[model samples]
Target: MNYIDNDPRLQTGKPAGIDKISIWIHPFLIREPSAFHPSSGNNKKVILRYTSRNGFSIDFQAEFFDPFKNIFIQILEYLIGLSIRGILKSPINKDFSTVEKCFCTLFTDLFAIDCIEFYFDFMRGHLILSNITNQKYKTTRYSNNYTREGKSVIIAYDRIERLKYVNQMNYDEISSIIYPMRFEFKLNRTNCEYLHPTNIFGNYNVIFDNYLIFLAKRWRMYNQQVVSIPVLNNLYYAEKFKTIIQYSQWQFPYSMMNLEKTPSCPMPNKSVKLKDIDRNWAVQFSLKDWV
Candidate 1:
């Protein structure tokens, strides 16, 4: 959805906008070099064409083209339709935009969308990615994310905890504001919509819509969950109980928070299950913040 420049809420990083994008162009297929149209002195031609070989690929922070007068966009659509293969990346962290940086390729291998990763940073619900879904697919978990493979592939993982080591942290120091526990979704060629060269912008909207639907459907599946405790689980549990016991004279003791042994997964127990599994991050999410 190419929107007007005046629309503030639909800024880049928002649901309708993209964080990073990769485009692959087959110059051999683009024989119509005369398609480019010129404009005013400074804002003239849209593309800075360069030959491509061994290399295949190629936004704006918000809107690449001003909806009002966009010859540049028109030329892009035309060229893309002629020869294009692309990878479109979207970030769940709308607050931090990471636009792609593509330069002309002479010897580099073509850019491939091996998979698309949707990072739900600081949010969690491991069970959802455990295999539950509205659509059926082979589900498997290794390393961190849940993966579904077929016409397309999707990978979901924990962002904060995975990066804990970068900050010199073990799971012992997690935060609720950074919760419920964020996840990342990785999608392959078949699953990504932003690859359509002629309609990258339009496809971006579809990508965002599909994501919101996936989350909404999963959220509606159950009002609560009985969860397995990981080192991360203890943190979620600790925060959840604080709210539950707020009125009780006896507060939940910090010592009872299972903080022994420095084991990453917390104390080993076979039968411990926490119910009404708290998704603190999702609980506080508002679509308005995105759109």
Candidate 2:
């Protein structure tokens, strides 16, 4: 399988100006020397074939011998699970979510590691750049009162204040304060798997989930006008809450706005033609009726 070095700097953990490196994974079948032995047949093997832009190539194979067998098998499984087909088929410039899912699944499911935390750490620099760009866009796109960055910052600040007040601690001490709270909640779980933080990965999972819930709650609180009402109860708010629910997964969309135009007047009591009604109002009414 071919693996291009689109991000070679990631491998060295440093920014280097180099052309793309070509990578290939091939089966390194080895035939036994003994002809009479039952295990004389070719043994299964795998090797990584790396080729630089200058045509310099190197082949490396893992020692799948006794002591390293288990760890090497896990690593191989992870590499295989990151579908080679997807990588080849994907466009040169891929979306963040696609890359995130591929790497997260490769690390989390195959290696039993907390890839999301690693992902956050890996993207911290990019995120800082993104925030700066987004702030500039917000400044240019909207008025002071309607600036998304201002609103988001205020909401975040308020959440931090509430956390400090409720936990009786400073902002820096919030993690220590919330750890016990999270532990108590996890203890309530009936499943033995979650009863204790058996390993670092397990503990990280708990921390990550709790952190997501905390952020979700803060977001919901900030956008109470859109989230307080049921997703089914209002079409306007449902559309607005879709992105929020995607991030949080704490709310459900029981009903959705009807983008399709009604053929006839759905409401009998109201002597209003479907076409005559305002588009937003008509959609909302139709959605309620459909639900």
lDDT of each: 0.30, 0.25
lDDT of 1 by residue, 102-176 (tens): 111111111222223333322354334453332332222232222354322333334454445346444656443
The per-residue C-alpha lDDT of model 1 at residue 165 equals 33
| Consecutive 10-residue window with the lowest summed lDDT within model 1 | 98-107
Candidate 1: where are CA atoms >4 Å away?
A: 1-20, 27-152, 165-180, 190-194, 203-207, 210-291
Clashing pairs in 2: none
TM-score of 2: 0.15
**Per-candidate TM-score against the hidden true structure:** 0.30, 0.15
| Candidate 2 lDDT by residue in tens digits, 125-197 | 1111112223423211111223422222111112233455456456676543311110001111111122111
Every model: Cα RMSD to truth: 22.5, 26.2
Q: What does the lDDT read for residue 159 in candidate 1?
A: 41
